[model samples]
Target: MGEAGFESRFVAASDGLKLHVRVYGQPRAGRLPLVCLAGLSRNAADFDVVARDISATRQVIAPDYRGRGLSDWDPDWQRYALPVELQDVLTVTAALGIERAVFLGTSRGGLLTMAMAAVRPTMLAGAILNDIGPVVEATGLVRIKDYLGKLPAPETMEAAVALLKTIGAGKFPGLAEADWRRQAEGMWTMRDGRLAAAFDPALAKTLEQVDLDAPLPTLWPQFDALAGVPVMVIRGEHSDILSAETVAAMAARRADLDVLDVPGQGHAPLLADARSIGRIAAFADRCDAA
Candidate 1:
């Protein structure tokens, strides 16, 4: 165990892939365990800040999808689809003896939460979606597609930080240099004496079918499946993915929804900030009470 008080667990998926699941803290007597899911191309490191804090009162589990982080890369890139990823999440949680959990998903993680609600409703105690919804904006997808697997590998940590700030400073204007630096550290890793993006480059294959000119499929039914549970959405003020229109639609469907808009951020709000995390911690308390 490291200073974060989290243990690294390697769980085997049904397909025989090895997955990394970070387990943090001891379970509180009454608090529901929190399962964190990261975005596309992101890894377990993304949850380092929030889990370190949230795990103080309740257990937190953050899993890296097969192709990201320390997990084994899938031989068939097509297995990177959500169905496979969802199975991996279930497998990891089950291995950890977690029958149910309050899911906190960021970006692609949020999508998996909805899928979980549809296929395994009993496992969902509550949900927190960070800047993602049934209706994903194509513009945001385009932006992500343009950069995935194409980022330049910088020679040093400082160079990596500068690259991130140069590319991301516009959307996440609220983030400080220190914030960008941390992001740099998490987004890349050293391998073969060279710095590279943390995720397998083959992940780009999954986006090859995305049609920029066409509307992507929506998951309103999946979102609706969570109507019985407490739900919270944390959106960036400048987010291009979870639009205001979609949020209004979500609210229309479920009026009890808790929405937090983080100013000066875009697409997804980093739950790393004290204010954002405090709200999430409070939401967890309510989930426990419910």
Candidate 2:
């Protein structure tokens, strides 16, 4: 509810696919920017709480990847992977005329940040990784796949609330029933009186090929790209996505690295909450200071 406006635009990627984006901030003639990137299945609006709280001094840009939110669905759903999304982020930066910007990345967005750091290190000011690490837990990935595209469409708001209660019960704890209901409406869209997932259903296809036994690819090269840049990583104490041991390992290598662990959360900590929000803002302020 700040003075931020949601203006939608499109930036054409090298592959000629148009990626949708939303901007939140006042027009600044000369000022460095701050960008927010959402989780795998989330859209730009996922940053609404964070952006609205910081728009006074930072130009916040949020993008909906090829297969999510208002963006066009890829003809080849396999292109929904991280490699393609990284290219799309570069295209977005080029379109915005931003030389460098601080990244407030959540989940998949955090992985994309590491990829960018490896592929194009010069474009980033710094990065705050929210509940994601180079290594991921197979258990969480498997749990996510179980409901990838199997959730039933809710016919009414009440039905949507009920669906969220049943599905999100274990996922997001410590939230009231009303909070879960609000989150459900935000994640879906109303289509012909039924509440449907806002993202393209084809995105679920990526989960079908996930191999849990194999070790996930190492992203050290990507993390190396952030060598001289300020980096902060936030993890949920109960998160399966980023284990505390891995985070400690990352910190050992980089003495300047900052780490935070949110209690009573798992997989990913909701950044919109006040406790995490303040930490993220402080990280950005440190980036500016440097």
Candidate 3:
């Protein structure tokens, strides 16, 4: 457990791999837990700011999915599939004694949120889909694949930040140097005095199975299952992955869905900013009251 108020704990997956989860704040009776799920190749650190900000109101749980952060890596990379990841989530929730939670899922994590809704709708009090939807644009996916695991480890933190800037230049326009440094730190770790990506390289292999030439699979059914639950969706204004058209369709289907399109961002917005965090907190409070 971390001494910084938050508790760092591990739960064993069915296959015996240990998955790490950081618990923030004390549990309040009748208040729904908030779980922040990171994007592909990202981990619990991605939620540091938002989790800390909202922990005062309700318990916050951030998990380092298998092969990311302190979690045990799967020898079989294929196990990185969504079904296995979903089970891992279930195991963590069960171990934590949480019957229901309001989930904040980013990118790939958002897809997992939809999957969970389909398989276990009762487990979700609400969900915030950050920069993701039923349909994924091939262009964004192709862009991600272009460098997913191809970048070499940086020799210094400065180099890591530079690399990130070069790669993420126009995507997150107006992000300050400090924000980029924070992002670099979150995505990579210093090991042997060099910076390396925080996730297993095999994680990128999962993307190889995607057929960019063909249409990507839609998760409308999984999304439809969330109709009973309060839901919020956040989109990066310039995101290539979650298009405006898809968000419109989602809103058309669920009139109650709350939507936020963050300006000057792309693919995914790092929910660390004040405005985004405040909006999410408000949505969560509403869910808790409902």
Candidate 4:
């Protein structure tokens, strides 16, 4: 639950598609703003709790990438690639008049953060990557592909919660029943009195094209571009996407990198928990002090 009365706004992407942003809290002078980027198929709502908590000290902004949440869906699904999404993020930063920010990126968002560091290093004050790294595990990619865009429409809220729990059982072990319900609310939208997934079904096409048998592209160079900027990497102990080996490599590359391992979570740890939120807040404080 982010602060009440957050401003809902939009900016146009290079393709003329409208992208949505949720701005929370007030901007404090001399403090770097926080920009949150969600995972693929996720929206600004995913950071509701985190925004509320951090905004008390500095401004927090979360944007729904094109084709997800309130943003305009691309008619050509191929535009959903990383380069295009990275440009869209740049457009958002420009539209908001943000000169610099501490990026809090999760999953695909974390990949975008690395891309930004490579292309627009000066714009980033720091970054915290949640459950993602230069190397992605094939097992995790397979799991995501299994149900990416193929989720069935739920007849009721109860059904939606059940579906999420069924698919997310081992992934989010300690999450309460209420958290699952909240996740359902964020992931699906009620249209014409029926619940359908909030994101465009075409999003799955991007994953479908990936050949798991072949090696996936490595982003280590992009990560290396962030050498001077402060960085924090968080990993869920059971995360299939961000393996322990990748985390070690990331740490090896950046001697000053802050690392945290959240126990009992899988692909990603929800930042709503006190421990995660506190860690982020402390990391931001250090970035600001520097």
Best by TM-score: 1
Report the lDDT of model 3 for residue 208.
96
TM-scores for every candidate against the unseen true structure:
0.98, 0.92, 0.97, 0.97
Report the candidate with higher TM-score, 2 versus 3. 3
**Compared with the true structure, what per-residue lDDT tens digits does model 3 show for residues 55-125?**
98899999999999889999999999889998998999999999899999999899889988989888898
Model 2 spans with C-alpha error above 4 angstroms? 1-4, 27-31
Candidate 1 residue pairs in backbone clash: 239-267
**Tens digits of per-residue lDDT for model 4 on 139-212?**
99999999998989999999999999999888888999878887899999987788888899999999988999
Q: lDDT tens digits, residues 1-290, model 1? A: 67757899899999888999899998778989999999999988888889999998999999999999989998889899999999999999889989989999999999999999999999999999999998999989998999999998999999999998888788888788778887898899999999988888999988887777887899889999998899998889888899989988888988899999899899777788999889999999998899
Total backbone clashes of model 2? 1
CA error at residue 202 for candidate 4, angstroms: 0.8
Runs off by more than 4 Å, candidate 3:
1-5
- Candidate 3: worst-modelled 10 consecutive residues by lDDT: 1-10
Weakest 10 consecutive residues, lDDT, candidate 1? 1-10
Candidate 3 or 2, higher lDDT: 3
lDDT of 2 by residue, 69-111 (tens): 8788899999999999988888898898877888878889999
Ranking by TM-score: 1, 3, 4, 2
Candidate 2: worst-modelled 10 consecutive residues by lDDT: 25-34
What C-alpha lDDT does candidate 1 achieve relative to the native structure?
Answer: 0.91
Scored by CA lDDT, what does every candidate get? 0.91, 0.81, 0.91, 0.91
